[model samples]
Target chain A: MSNKLLECVPNFSEGRNKEVIERIVDPFRKTEGVKLLDYSADKDHNRLVVTVIGDPEGLKKSVLEAMAVAVKEIDMNNHKGEHPRMGAVDVVPFIPVRNVTMEEAVELAKEVARQAAEKFNLPVYLYEDAATSPDRQNLASIRKGQFEGFKEKIKKPEWKPDFGPAEVHPTAGVTAVGARMPLVAFNVNLGTDNIEIADAIARKVRYIGGGLRYCKAIGVDLKERGIVQISMNMTNYTKTSLYQAYELIKVEARRYGVNVVGSELIGILPAQALIDVAVYYLGVENFSEEQILENRLLWG
Target chain B: MSNKLLECVPNFSEGRNKEVIERIVDPFRKTEGVKLLDYSADKDHNRLVVTVIGDPEGLKKSVLEAMAVAVKEIDMNNHKGEHPRMGAVDVVPFIPVRNVTMEEAVELAKEVARQAAEKFNLPVYLYEDAATSPDRQNLASIRKGQFEGFKEKIKKPEWKPDFGPAEVHPTAGVTAVGARMPLVAFNVNLGTDNIEIADAIARKVRYIGGGLRYCKAIGVDLKERGIVQISMNMTNYTKTSLYQAYELIKVEARRYGVNVVGSELIGILPAQALIDVAVYYLGVENFSEEQILENRLLWG
Candidate 1:
């Protein structure tokens, strides 16, 4: 069997203060098993995004250490950010990397939530695939009122925290822990400057409007570039690959005689996604990732 | 910087004797740094192929251990095979995997060749990318004949062994050592049963016939299946991506109204190859392997 691998992307609400951000991320750097691939801080958004990969046990340990620092150093009452926030530590989503089932990832989420609640006396809400109730499955549903509104909402029956006391923490606020698929930010630009046509195509291709499944699409006018775009977030590529989404948008945009200018993948993507597109576009038969020499060189 | 990685494929002359083959391969299995990825024995060809990947040092140690075993157990005079043979331990080709330059690989080949000649008293010839002489750069030129023909060929000034005595070893015989790029066996089957069309298309696509550079193409008739194929081996994928080759063949085959049934990659390929194809086919702008979540996870 292949080796076990998992990805963890954690968001923190103290990006403006460099010392605080580094202090909070210090534990991850010191951790043995987990590797800290990258971390970025945005002053405007007042948020820090950290990317990590490691064995499940090691990742859990590192997250706990980092959270302890966050709880000790960050106070929600003094925090202000453009982005939505409910805790100093904010949101943490665990993604299965290799040889790990989504079910196992959910279990890991629960384990992390339970430990955080017991260790720091903080409230934790399970969202997405780890949700105990159907309503909490969507993170927005759990974070409905943001921090201020959630303070009052927590006292209600449905708004109770999944792993802590119904009462919100004194200053650390609340955290949402979940297991979910990686989200790929993909965008396709049209050669024409027809904003209405781009909007129509985006609406036609998005999931809510009966387009591709697992795709959330929206049209935005690239005013500076004199073009239109179909911005999309592929929440689950396994169900609807990049090629499917691109082709759909291409065909849909062509209805108005608009030609595709180009496409951009906002962030990192899985190797399998690229392979899937290659097979479809190149008409390659019986191609496998194992057929990739570099991949084989990675392991016996 | 990342650790330097290399792939080595060693060919042995004794495939019929399972016990002898196992004994010869034991060193590779036990070596610390070297990873023995695969080994295959062909009775008809009477050859054993062992695939390994590792650091330069790891490969050197493993090769020596395996050579010692081969020297003790096999004799070239008694050897019989459908494939060419000059030694019990026939040929070893080192391929740079990652972060290792071709020059470094050539130096490694020379060191291994010198060690083999000095330690085992086996004559050695360098070929392919590591050849010292322009004429010896090709394997066929160095291996002019099977073991029997090579005995006489070795005495000639032009055909003298690069290392060890002018005479071949009494039992173990001579071994060829060199550094070369990985060869990808790529075959494309035509949807129609037109042998003449396949042959003409193959002629138009191969390097010798002015098709794609770094590509060797031949047309074969799959008589039983009643389909013709354009069989090719891509020596350098960086210069020619899989999709580029497939696209050209598709275009040429179209001249005769031949539809491409499918393409086959005979062995392992580098991840970059597939990534390139995906980028071309999907029109993915500025795509990178690091964007793959799985690849990022592996790095971390």
Candidate 2:
């Protein structure tokens, strides 16, 4: 692990257009030192999310280049999506991957936000760990009414932009830049097709409803698979491990006589999270990362 | 993620002499492109094992340079150790770490063996997947009576050197070079200190006694800890996962009402092995290596 490594997940407003989405993510591939881990465009939400990992210096340069492309190609005023949005390059969150701390990631986010706000004259709101105000800690609060409604909402003394002018950019819109922990999108499917059961279980497991501290969950009907799923976004795996959340769900579902048929980790996850699950389930008393041969090879 | 990565574990005959062991292992660290993953000198065994991983070309050069040092610094004729041995530069195994195949690793082993034999005139024996004869496939069989007895044993046609003259080097002695799958040193300690019960369980679970294939296990007393351990060497983890072995041992130990205290992975292991354990334990229905964030980050 290198102390300089950082993880960045940037959201873009236009996900429906394949060409435009590729163009926006092209900078991550073209840029040196940055590793483009994953990128996906959701058609229904009309949103694109790109996952990138690299050194702080390299990632800062890559995000600027990506923003330059997104600003020119995307017209946020015409953007129509089910998901919330504030800019063409909607939200950029810097995450400390390894050998780096949250505080350092916050500093990196501020540096990136400063550059984007100054160079493009676009308003930037720091959310989560990089928030300038306590009200900015939650992204929903920062982007309460999306771009159109929030455009006028800015100019208020409490809603002034963290960077850029009080006015929102007409076409490009304002962007949210912040630091956050790595988020793991995990879901478990039950044997029964009862969507109600899944919903009740989700309510009991989500943080908003006094469940797992770092989890936000919802139950969805998987029509094609003929099952219901408790889709969850584990915002912080270290605080609430996959095993702890999964066993809780399993135990909760069993009360309704529902058997967990399967589970899915939708996106990239940290190696330690998986190791934690392994150690828990296998009863591997004192297994360390060095016990993993591939890890040893990488360290070597 | 590199296409040409290779891992080499070289064992030398001098562990007691810190200076001699250091001199023998220094070339691996000094060599360009080669990463010295780890090295250990065991006084009880009087042997040094140096682990190196890197580009194939650089690894081969480094191994040869290290062997030159071993040949000049150590003499096997007067060598004394608790562990079995055959030469100053005893055994060198080329392991395919990533983006490499067993056949390619075999080719590499043969090439290194040829160079060692031609340069140092030390007789070489190929074992494991690189063995020419079925009898030679087992390294213990190749080193049957160790260095002292093997000198006279080499006179037979069945013990002919794979790459050198029929005779062993006068001072450095003979060497064994081969290609092998990564071996995981996994052990499960029992809460009780009954060596007899542990031995009985080991026999029932070891491959030779019709247990798991690709698994070699034995029972030993952890005297200082007051526990009996089922020490295991998983020769091929892809075939027999770590959880499978641990589960079997748990079942076998339960007959005598013994519980598992802890387990340990003695050295470096492949990341896939840990991933396999994670998938098994987490009940992750459909997981891919891409789901591991660190793996994806390393891909670039």
Candidate 3:
């Protein structure tokens, strides 16, 4: 609660079983200092994503506790799911929320990795900011073989785990721990149901399409709502803001004789991203986040 | 900070002396749970306003400590200022910011008032929501005739102090303590420099002229910026939001062909006020404040 905030989103393998999910999520709910922001279990993906925020000490403790439950409940040998995951506790990413620096978050992730490997005898990959090597930085590259293929892939000289034995565990499998910036799930809905308008805007507003450098967007048709939405993941809000993508979509839609009906923020987002919108739209000059009342309390 | 949040803005007389001002504000900064959100001194008005937020216990302790300092340093008999005053420590307002209700805030104000009356032997009047009588609810009515007049005014039956001795303190004078909703100091700058357009729009957008219920607006000329401004105090953002005021001002400005050049928020404001702007402009339906990352932590 006293500044130095860190956000941990740990993805566990068990999602379908009601009792198992509860057991895995118990530590996060019961932890004193940790604030469980969100937790969801998708039956189709058979994956659980738990979002929690707290100081370094409390967050790390809660994460390891949840990891232990996931290890005990999920047996990778018999586990089957559509999502590509390499372990029972698939990916644990520590994001710097407030006063915490990315380097500090990386150190925290490494600490968790070091602890998990010894306590559970599970192979851990330090991906992203905590990655030992350049190739290990991408979670997908490290998780290329999945749990089954990783059993043999671990024997490769280049594919050695960062912690624990050079071999995979019997039940728990492998997990990725790292640090990364906060991602914003922002979507802009178009006036017309025609998805073509959405696709056109998405191309003009995404990184690969030579638009905003930090955006990854795709057109989605909300069939029930009778609109087309440019569902987006703002990978780096600081670099390419929500307003940047939103305004571009508005501009692109105008060419097609379409209006942006509305926009949506799908999941949780950092408060600064939202405040930036107000500052931009209102043309409030030299406005600092310090002026936000709640922020002063949390800044600690 | 754990859900039961309260905002206290304590205004004290004597703004010219920086040494005395710091002494008054030091307790709020030193207290553990209390957060010093903002503090400003107006030389002309000769007043010091300190905005702090904390839990009930911590907030109460800081306010009382500051009151003692004001009592020791300031003597109303020799005090002279342009602004209205009835005490060394003039007014203390408790506001519900996050999860705390208005009723709970009123209770907190009462506790502070009772303690101030006992410790400092100062006459205390509860205004706004904490007022025992309807007449006392309005601070101005209770503060009639200023410090020089309140001595004789207190002899009347209707003017009996809510707490403390029936008479005011020999040096400290009398103060008002109460609870109320958070106010937003919002100002919209017009493209034109003409003061008439700003005045006309202000009349159309304020409550007295049949506009938004919770808005009080005035026209101002920002000579340095060469723009006329519609300065406003949105007394209740929940009922009359920033976007509502901004949008209405835009619509009204159309008649005079003056674009809203910019807007500014003076001092501190609740985070929800800014979030509400994004929700309205973006057309985000069914969005909850709980979804804000920083808020999730502060919600406790």
Cα lDDT tens digits, model 3, B114-161, are 999999999999998999999998888988899999889988989999
* C-alpha TM-score for every candidate: 0.95, 0.95, 0.88
Off by over 4 Å in 3: A17-23, A26-34, A57-65, A114-121, A130-138, A141-145, A151-168, B16-36, B41-44, B57-65, B107-124, B131-144, B149-170
* CAPRI classification of candidate 3: medium
TM-score, B chain alone, candidates in order: 0.94, 0.96, 0.92
lDDT of 2 at A1: 29
Residue by residue across B1-300, what tens digits does model 1's lDDT show? 137778889898888999989987888788887777778889988889988888888889898888888887888898888898888889989998777899998999999999989999989999889998899887877776878887788888988888888998999888999998878788888988878888898899888898888888888899998899999988888887777778899999888887998877777766777778777766767766677665654443
- Model 3: clashing residue pairs? none
Ordered by lDDT, highest first, the candidates read: 3, 2, 1
Tens-digit lDDT string for candidate 2 (B1-300): 246787899999999998888788888888887888889999889999998888788888999999999999898888999999999999999998778899999999999999999998889999999999999999899987888887799999999999999987888888999999889888888998899988988898889988999889999999999999999999999898989889998899889999988787777776778778878866777688878776775554
| Residue-wise C-alpha lDDT for candidate 3, range A33-124, written one tens digit per residue | 78888899998788999998888988888899989989888999988889998999999999998778889999999999999999999989
Native-to-model Cα distance after best TM-score fit, residue A81 in candidate 2, in Å: 2.6
lDDT of 2 by residue, A144-258 (tens): 8888987678978899989887888888899999999998888888988999999999999999888999999999999998999999999998899888788889989988999
lDDT of 3 at A277: 81
Off by over 4 Å in 2: A16-23, A290-300
Better of 2 and 3 by DockQ: 2
